[model samples]
Target chain A: MSGIQKNIIKTLLLIALFMLSENMNAQTCCAAGAPIGSYLEIQTGDKRLFSFQFRYEYNNVNRLVENENRIENDPRTRYGQSFLWKLDFSLNKKLAFSAIVPFVHQSRNTISEQQSSFGIGDFSFITQYTHFKGRFRSLNISAGIKFPTGKTNHRADSQILLSPDMQSGTGSFDFIFRSSASKTFSSLPFLTSYASALFRLNGMNNDFGSTSTFVGRQFAFGDEVNSQIGARYLLTLKSGFLTPDIGLKIRWANHNLEQQQAAPNSGGYWLSLPLGVSFAPNEKKSIAFTAELPLYQKLSGLQITTAFRLGFQINYTFQKNKTDDILN
Target chain B: MKNLLFLTILLLFGCNKDDNQAQTDWLIPFDEVLDGGPGKDGIPSVDAPQFDNVSDISFLNDNDLVIGMFHNGVSKAYPHQILDWHEIVNDDLSDISYALTYCPLTGTGIAWDRVIDGSKTSFGVSGKLYNTNLMPYDRATDSYWSQIRLDCVNGTQINKVINTYPIIETTWSTWKAAYPNSEVMNLTTGSNRNYGSYPYGDYRTNHSNIIFPVSNTDDRLPAKERALIVMGDQTKKVYSIELFAEDRAIEDTIDGTTIIVIGSKSKNFIVAYEKGNLTEVVAVTDQLPTIATDTNGNRINLDGTIESGPLQDVQLTTFNSFIGYFFALGAFYEVEIYE
Candidate 1:
């Protein structure tokens, strides 16, 4: 197969791997992925339930603009890819640790394409505390910082990765903080209403891309902060042994960096809704899968990227109380 | 109690009601809602960059002009929104002369005539913020230091604001003077786009500042503290930026994480203004800079940074080609000094 076809296949496989891992185990308090249907598990006080999870994905970096205004793909630099890995550990019902490392493979392409690429992508680490049941339903809040651990060079701007042209890392440090509130309801025998809103804070990342275009040097990515929030709902088949689920989500985000100058100071709202599914062979090991397709992308015209992320997770339930998880 | 337990169990294993349909698409465009012109909000109605002549400050073309140019087949003057905000912004390479004049802090475009004063050439932020300059036009009040005029801003003796500077020279004169030390480069010679004085070469990180003159004094608006870059769109459009820093540094105030912006006292990060839009993306640098000591013996980071693009004759959405990415459609240069 041509390199472009292979890359598309690889990207899909990576998504499959990510989704499968999310629900591989069902009993752990913090599975490989977040709770499939938004069942908030608050650590109100000292309720000890623990687990660990991780996710890794790599996207073949190739950008092609179609004549019909559609961005296309090229096979020459098929090796170019975006590699990302996530590690998560739940201390108990109330706390969790998150770490992510992203890499922009500049040398993956032939020497010709390499001439325009830039520096390495960065890494992020965050740890949050969950207040199982605070004032409302289950609420979770996490705060952490993103460090510029990747390389910074303008040598990689030529890649088809997406804009704000971050080939590698922009040597500036960024801090990220997120607060989330969720309430899940069993509205019907097989339906669950899951809603959660997150407030995210982003710091500046100004290593400047490979080119001296005015935007890169504007800040360090310059000192700025931005926010994004999303909410989702899922449907499940609560049968004897296997529990399968499906759902949707909506998200709104805004950003104001030293860049995006002509845009509104605040920003236009972006809305995204995803349909997802979750299943469990048994209570001890539960599985969740999801696909996020942007309903509307008004903010960044990163078009030609008919992009969607498929995620899967599995978690093993620990000690159970009643008949269901107890017997398993 | 049994029902409560059953309810909890149901809640944990219930299904979600959202759809998972799949389809392919680019970003939705706002051309229709945008109404082919500037919005009442002093900004483009659509956030995305417009490539045709349907917007302000654009080049002249039936499809490109939002309001047709002042004269056909010639480099036209700027639109009111562009002019109202930025009174003068100069580029030293192109035959046509443009001045983006306005102040985010002062909240006015200043004035045009040298007598009005209080104006300075508005340049783009350093990088992709929206690069709109291919050369530098020395600016002060509405008047620029003109190599075009031998007298300079002698017309305005008004000390009230920045009412004086030098007269802006034409492209040939400006480059002849700005780069007298180095081999001069001019993109306007091809005769395809012969308006304004600015350079357009291949995509790059470095080019001479092709600077002419803005005003007499620094205008007290430090380069770093001034507005970010503004890049032009295909439709004579401009994308603006309002990059803000903390109002006060740690030395200026006590313990605080306040964003620290340009105006607020407590200090904070805020978006104070917006400029042009980015069509194509590229950086220009004579030489990349790192932190170093200045000739004045002060510790500083001297970066030969310049942001420029819009590779002429290309649409913003149509910029996915390697050739388009590398071609120098427009030019921009700036020397940033940070301590």
Candidate 2:
């Protein structure tokens, strides 16, 4: 196949991979960062592109258990919502850079106490590099830094320190590492598969000066590892192509530590199933939607579980000039 | 992978203020106490308590608990519904300022006189717990006083014990019957808090375990069993309410001081008064009775006054006391039980 045909096929495979893999961040208390869909693929050819994305996520916490015992219902329940903006820029085909900025709102209500917080959440910057290329497969690796830019010093009733989960930010810097691979089936022309793995290392927040907890003691969120695999089938249409994708994502995390000791009820594991559809009218634009259902989840302690989640995105691809190689 | 390793090493070594130990001169060692989540005044102590006539109270159930206080002919009841949320109420009755402190965890309540250093002040919840007891802080010095200990454990005024007034812990129905014309705390606390629900779910009923750590434990009784406790300068005594109800009345001596514990199971009320070699004390009536006959065949009113006898002018001192959980009495005081 020609280079142009190979590039088109690669792009199609990526479109399918994103639909199945892009879902939520781990739904842990006080966790930050964007959903998986926000991750951009590394371009290996000498084609430059830029895109922007907006996303919103929400969770309602109604159940909590401690040490395997379910906590009884309280007059208070927590609701967490986040808005994120992601920017992706392909510096060159071989390298890419992406940045995400988020705003978070959290609210909790109890008998005499009703509190809410809204502010910018943590920000992340990532760089992706194409490491290898083969006859029908490509590999990319990525590294990123998450900055503690969100608001952390929020109080309820002007004096009470809200729990870390209620704060918009974790007040800590984190490091991220990820790798992904995609392959096109030679026998099945319209089919492709992709897989990816990621790890995040959380740093200690020095400003954890809440009179509660350990006074002046620092806290670090537990490290996290997430992996997913998915496949997509392409169906030809009169105007564009319709792609249906399915994937499963699994995440494992350690308990958040305080003053070098593991904080109780702070960590767990989860598995989720993502189903999605993408419709592209032409090579220049496409729209996608995904609905994630939790298949199996067993948290470390009692926690608010996700009933379901939904996400949508619109993409418009633009080239600086009509590439002579693409039109030829 | 190499870049990931390098960044990890940099972050591990790039320590910030978290690397240094914080400078805190905690009067009470850090490990002995636990943060109750809310900061100072987080639970919000009532500085101005409002009351409505018994006829106006619509929220309390007959079985709900209340703290009844009486002074200089004025009587009022503070419902646990309000205390369950605020934990402390700073108010004045008969011109005497007091901090009515209640700890939900230990089911203990006490009225502390707020006169410190000759000036009156208010108290607030410190959002700190010691042995599952409430720790109140005075606004005058920000000193945290252990609710059961009744002494400042941290901050200025350390080691100072405030004077304690007397209070009675009884069911709302019992209190209303005793003082039919008394006023009850109104739920309109101005903070827009729900007055109907308990914030901690099943906590009052689940005595199997405590949410926070306590320093001591005694298996003499269940953690939640109610006990009438009396604390003297150097002596402490406990009478289990279950046994008190079974016996109705008991005369016991502790540390060479003899006292009489009287119980009315139907009214769910208990009180202790000093006894001096009295041969017999019998009630003339039942169910909220007011007349009793002492060993000398003298008629006595509920207030321990001689209505008829040679000792007509003599009066028995009723020690200032409150009824709380058996676990709290055992946890905080060196107790001599009157079985």
Candidate 3:
């Protein structure tokens, strides 16, 4: 056997290993801050490299569902849009740090009432480390903390405080853990397969609806697990590389707890398929567009679930040249 | 530099200010009114409800609770399975229009006349709660009415009291056996909802589960235990269904007025009426519209109607009474338990 064939075998083995380790947990049913996984895709390079990315996301939730069945003709609908800015700095070949800031706007509409809220969302800071690096595959692990920076006490036009799901932030400090792996085969040099899993351990917000009293005011978003697997193929162009990717994502969340009891219609499992295309004009800049469609959902109780999601991202990298490194 | 400026501008645009808040002059304490998660009409009300004969209905379990109403020689049953999803049902029968309102959190059900000041209008769930009970709103005047308070607490019709009708809430099997020819509200409520499922999980049986804060808490009985409460001038008395282990009746004087309470624990029903001429009342069985009889040969039904004897077809004036969760009754009124 040649070295190329050996590399292909190694890549296939890595893919199989990660696929078997995928964790299947549940997800929350309402709008939240953008998942940390969306901003964890950092490119491994030399030290002193810095990158910035901005993303816009739009989600529409209108389908009223009970368990796995869709209840048709529901007039209630919710729309969420978010703008996120992310910054990344590489300390070495194996270590990196990232920070993200988000702004979110949400609206819910029925035949008789319309409510909209907008504000700054929660902020997150993550530290990622490259655990394994080989010619055929690489593995990255990340851990982060989310701050309760968003406004949770926003009231509606009627002066009634909006529900937790409608607020821009969760009002709770949360912990996020993720592991991602990517592989490239020698026979298919332009194709790459990747898999990632993320788990968010949520904290409790003692001042969920009212800041005045704590008797029955505690609210905690359910912990969530999101996993995805996919492959991307790159097409080389004269000025850039155009890459198209598709993936199957499974998300599961436990029911939210209100006053130490599980809240109804709050959490469930969701399976979605995401497709995206990215254009890297050069190594320093890239733009990507993605669309996610929910294929199946089994919510804990009755809830309005996501119909579809659209996202656009722009990335810019600042490279540290030899002269800059010498100056430092 | 330009990119950062543009992003800063975008983030500034995301911060919104609400300057068009609706001015509310609430008759009740405004801070006590809490949002029930779903917005107004989020839990849609049944406007043009569909019905099926009791024999044709199959979605309800034998032990499932129902709200039964009788008027103009016709009987109807509204299952809690349906009411658990749609808390209000607006219906008309033989020129009588009323709304059946049930609050899942508080476990209280009442029937209110749809006519307000001689104008007919339907009611919708306001998605607001007082003492964790439902607050319904009239479609005509957009006024919020407390289900347990039986009065408008907000909007144009503040402080207006609604007239209520008498209803007997019992198990589906018991109601079906007594009123087999009754019409039941079916699942075809036009709005798609899961009628087979109880929306609140374990809330009916969990003694310690109270989702929202109550103004008053009573540990005399479990919070979710159902009891019949009769309201008088500045007085409220509670009669636990468990007190009637067998078919029995109790004559008690409350607020200087004599009242008769008839109930059966096995049948899961309790009804009360002002004692005017009722004498020698005793429990009877297997007679439709005749759960009790008197020595004067008068057969009394669940609706306090006299079916025979000297007062045939005459209706007994009922005291303001209804079945509610013990915690809810305690929250609204300082209730005295009838031993």
Candidate 4:
């Protein structure tokens, strides 16, 4: 491959790696509104000045587990789908801003009953600062605020306020912190490795489940930490580059507090493997598909865990300067 | 961009409300019945439970609580460790079939006859709760019954009362000693569960660990305090276990009906019987099958069977009663606490 072809291949691999790592943070269960992990914007390389991306995520939680043991006979299942739109604008080589808007649809099913909710979910605004940029490596840190744009008071058909887990929004303003880094090997310029970590400080919803007879109570989702490490390789094709990636993701959450007491079946640890493939038609656009499978899960109490997760993403970028290379 | 905006608007407004259209009529307030996370049969019921003789069982700790029942000269014990996970156990003894229903959230256990409308049917957890108490539904009629209220709260059999069998809730050591030949529900329940573990952490003992709000709050005692509550016609009274710390029986009246409550904090049990003719009943200690006695030397066994005296072989009728957490009893009824 020529030098320009190699550069395009590296950039494509990095984009695929970042996309795979960013999408690995979808919450396992009982998360209010859109998953906080979906707020992490993809790290579009310095060549792109602005980018718009849309992702569709489907998560199925049907595995009932107690600690580390799986209860095979539970019929309770929950399915969540989120449509996320993200916009990223780079002001300079070292600074960028991102905004994410999500629409969420959630449904829980049992043998006798079914409950579902759908609406606009929480929104996140983030500012990222590039800490270091080298020939083969880059580091970026970001901080953001999550707005309580979703509705927490969505009621069931019986006119009862749905539980926090079933609601479209948390009704609380939360804070998000994230950092990501990527590196390419000197010998293998077509392969890129990346890692990202995120921490979410959850806020409380004071008006949860308010009724005529009883006042609203306080509910807070547990704080969470999600981190992932992955590697992606690019293959040059006749029309585009095909990038395949794999990663290990770890998610840890503290027990949720309802009325200031630890809620049972609320928090746990999960380790999963995310596999994905991306097709970049050119430097300005790409499409990717990913699937996450749980390798190990240890929840606090008896809980329904995620069986698998599937996600599809499309990205379109506006470059600061146009290149006339065949690969572009 | 137009299609994206249209799709966004459609998803934002088209399917926002989550409605369960099947629930039409409810005897209680519909909004008060909260889904307890798990769905129907999510917390599986032990349909055909295996039992081990008291001497053959080895999994129970001395202080582990068990619900003891006796019928046709046969005794059986259901440990709290097992009940915390399964919540219901349907068992059959000869012609008698009953479901041992337990709610860890409310700390209450009551045995109800599986026969509803002259038909035999088992009960399953509805995965719904009122005042944080278990709401069980009968499989025959698919009707939901409130365990604390002992009445069908919803479905086809709404407002129907369920017949309850008296069960003795006591420590495992006390139960084994009282009925050495009793059969205890074993761990081979066919469900893959950690039977030795308590599913709800610190919920049983934490005074402020109530996950759901109660309609009525009685601040007279701590929320999680276990007490025996006797239900009468429009009247209910609670006798705390602390009142029987010294192993005594007290005669009390509820709506003009006389009753005798016998208990001991050390033994971790409280039992009550209708005071028909026997008088001056007093609690006893370390006597197997003999928990109380009257002035006429009538030996009252744990199951209320009179072993001797003028009422020999006659069983004392028990009042409608069960042990429950203080908060649950207060939330469901206007209960008067006996000092």
Candidate 5:
């Protein structure tokens, strides 16, 4: 069977596994996720390549605490699910382009109240340059911009503007910078490792005056920094190869400012462990899945905690000289 | 700056704007109701409220505001500090379902019967404000009702009049003093919110700054003037809280229905009751605030009891009255001020 057909079967199996696990246990709660962590492998061939990736993430926010104590008598909780589609184009060995499109659904439940929202989320575009390549390693640097392309004025059943966190997008411009490096061990050639750091500088949405129920006229989100390191070892089989990976990710965010004032319960830090697997039936196609579980979390104020973050991606590489490319 | 402006234009045109058309017959124009904040179900209503005896409430200060209700032989209190955050509470007392609503903007506290056409339904905040008053939507039919208007302005129950019950907007001290055994809502509301501070900064004290606009304003009273309001079948009347504080008693007629208003501003308690018979009234006691006197020379107590007349010990029937800012009354009614 071709790689595409084989990856499809593996994708279905992973989905079944996720369903079984989800039905067996409930995840813990907290919130915060962005489209990230793909494109770690830099292309080396002379032919241009195109890759498509999809990711699903869930964040649960339950506790709104102050001073680490759960605030009593207010039961406003939210769960956010996001689906992201990313396209990457490696035009040559030195240059690449990428874009992320997201859709989000948020559900809120109070003591006796519940509400939900579904819509397109923010979109991001990025450009990258490969600075160096060696027999065993590669280095790349990237810069990106995110546009406020989603609805920010969704209302509750009460005809009030939803809290900023519940909306599909932040309604702000964000600038992003990232650097990544990957190395293969010649002594143990089956092992490959990579590390990356990403930073986001957020802008403000000044339209909260007409859209907000609270007193704030403007809403500005906090800046964010994320660092991740992972390693994978390949296991060759008769039909394909299986790469099992383990990673650690750390995220830090500054407190969000509202109307130029520090908004309460708005920022925090999280440490997570990512466990993943990639199945490659051939070089041109692969299916990968990752599950992230937070090991430690300390928020500056009360916030919804993230129970687990899960991602799935099916990557297909199209080579210029391939039969598929000629047919197209 | 040029790059920023170009990006801003792209951002503005990239998303779809919400355009919901009016679907029901409205007493006021739909544009009059503006967005308050928090998307739909953003400020969730308390579905299952927890309660404790008045003595168990240690968080409430003497002057902290609370909405008091006596229904089906039960007395319950909902604090403004709590209601300000949630907006609505769907609760049942002695098997009768009721919705307790408070609009911080209009300073109106009302308890509504949750039954319409013999069916029980609950309410949620519609995230909408009419004349700075809360507009609640019934869950069963998704019809939006103006709290002050007491009518469903849109949706399946359009133009439907909601049944209202009586509640007293008073201070915590006054409510506890009167109904010492009453059940006060507990602060341990299984959610997260600061139950101590008012969410809207300095709103209770700010009189001149109107954040949301109302269609009409009556300069007869200050915009935030608190008053006792009585709603009859066709007419509505207001007894100024200041007048109730000064006279300690107000006897008036609305559309020929005789009513008496009494309360203590210092004590933070005010109530109105329907009068059934011929009456003469006077304020005779300084120590206890015994203000009512009948034609037959009987002193009546603030609890509507006739003190010395032939009908001594007889209690007058209390009306379903509530306290509101004059601005809210003007927003909903052609109100007659009791002279």
Candidate 6:
């Protein structure tokens, strides 16, 4: 117990030191290093503009059980880090093109289980076309194709949590498409809301079954895609340096097979309240960060959770004058 | 302009500044809400939590499924159908004692040992359970019950705690009643408007004057010969020493403790003097080496202070909408434990 306490103190000290250093270094987003947000987007704020973004994110998840049970570990923790780069260019005023590629490095292993596990996750590619562009907002429909970049077969020494299905990659092609648009508020304080609906057409993969004990691993299912609706309120503070954003998102997807077998289709709905702030250093350079909390997910045998997202944005100003003209 | 940027930076990094007062609401405590307990309905739920898939492996022989670890080996097949939905249904059968675990969130299924019969074993999920992963632990408690910072426990506000209960039922009304004084920070996340909406069991309103762990109380006396003491509002015990002795009170013993009866109906509870300390409570399984961990997986706090702030509130209310069902179903991954 004392050791635990000491470790806690050490962790706090480390955090304090990190914070202290962070203050001394003002990391304003630049083209040099991109951390999971807007850095690489080209001509993002204008019509007929080119854009790209590179993102890097780290996720830490742990599931612990109380009561020592005096038994070996029954908990699992996973740290997943990802690198994503995206490119989007408006082919013309009415048509647009976009692509996203992701690279991931993760080890799904457990110390208590005395088992070591590693794998890569599935990778995806997306392309889209703008069907319409309104005076205040524009609409684009995109088509996405995903490749199975993950390992379907993974074995370990002892027991662990990294399952084949849970691998960082899925070795198969999943076709998807989406339509997205964003409109800034006409009100005094800057407020903009965006909405997108994405669809997934399931692909065939032979890696799951024969290696798994799950039912769906035997046969491929039909199409499955997630439709997400989100809206954000960004209040451009009088100073314009800090803009706080409060957003809400709801997602619906089809992922359960047994229930689907029962109802030909059984899906789920997730409600999340995203709260964060956006920082604009100059008129053309800005960043938005948000935290996503799971409000409610009606499911069984699952622990309630609170998940969050921290995003940053650095828009590239190419042909600044033309971009400004487009915005006007 | 740069000066303004400095001020915004200061506001963003601040932590734990305005938190001082603690809740004193007598009606219901905040812990009852932030800390979850067993739910009302144990078996099935109205939401009909989706069960992804099921596979019957009863045909596998012991050699195919069982594996040797510390002192004994485990043959991992049973009640797979029941586990398909509940994920964590515990039972002691075939002389095999284990707790079933499943994460509907990640759709991962795995089993844990309650009392290791022979050897200590640390097994991971098969290639199937995707969302199913490892847990965090500390030496003080068995790694069995601890977790990392973001780990999810069975029934706790922080989403991380000891995993014991399989299902956790949360409701906004009950939480509000539990902490009426606390503000409703997020009307959407949860509201303080409703209370007592727990579906499984109500908060324990009636506690014995002398409950478990607490030593001095009238209820501890033998029922047969014990006295009934009631207090108005005086804070002090009005009738601390009331005696109504009966024949059985002195002569009989229930479950080893001497019983004392009082009142005509014998309806009054019993009391007994400490006849020697109660039997030693069984310690946590001591075989496995303990790993240091905190409730949230950081090292335990030395001063026993709360590492994270008080547990936050979880919204128990569920909402649905159109087009929400087109997604959320399908195979995410597979987990195979037994052969």
The candidate that achieves the highest DockQ relative to the unseen native structure: 4
Per-model DockQ against the true two-chain complex = 0.01, 0.07, 0.22, 0.31, 0.09, 0.02
Reference contacts recovered by each candidate, as fractions? Answer: 0.00, 0.02, 0.35, 0.40, 0.13, 0.00
Model 1, span B127-240: residue lDDT tens: 111122111123232221211111222223322222222111112222222222322112222112222211112112222221111112122222322221111121111111
Residue B169's lDDT in candidate 5: 75
Q: Could you give candidate 2's per-residue lDDT for residues B219-304 as a string of tens digits?
A: 68877777888877687888777764442657766567787777665556677777763557765545342445666776654445
10 residues in a row with least lDDT, candidate 5 chain B: B1-10
TM-score of chain A of each: 0.54, 0.77, 0.86, 0.86, 0.81, 0.62
True-vs-predicted CA distance for residue B22, candidate 6, Å? 60
Interface RMSD of each: 19.4, 11.2, 10.1, 6.6, 9.5, 21.7
- lDDT for model 5 comes to 0.69
Give every collision pair in model 3: A25-A252, A26-A252, A26-A253, A27-A252, A27-A253
Residues B155-258, candidate 3, lDDT per residue (tens digit)?
88999989998898999988988888889999899887777787777888887778777768898998888999998877899999989888888888889999
User: Candidate 4 — which residues are off by over 4 angstroms?
Assistant: A1-31, A36-39, A42-49, A153-162, A318-328, B17-24
| Residue lDDT tens for model 1, A154-262 | 2212111222332355455665555555443445333323344444344454433323312233323322322223333333345524433333444444433433232
Tens-place lDDT digits, model 5, residues B165-270 = 7776778876777678889998765456777866555456556645565667777888777887788777788888777555466677776788877766676667
**What is the C-alpha lDDT profile of model 6 across B121-211, one tens digit per residue?**
2222222222122222221223223111123222222233222211111122222222233222111111111111221111112122111
Candidates' C-alpha lDDT: 0.28, 0.66, 0.80, 0.81, 0.69, 0.31
lDDT of 1: 0.28
The alpha-carbon lDDT assigned to residue B231 of candidate 1 equals 17
RMSD of each: 22.1, 11.7, 8.9, 6.0, 8.9, 25.0
TM-score of chain A of 6: 0.62
Report clash pairs, candidate 2. Answer: A43-A93, A65-A302
| Residue A25 of model 6, lDDT score | 42
Candidate 5 accuracy as TM-score: 0.65
Cα DockQ of the candidate 6 complex: 0.02
In model 4, the Cα lDDT at residue B207 comes to 92
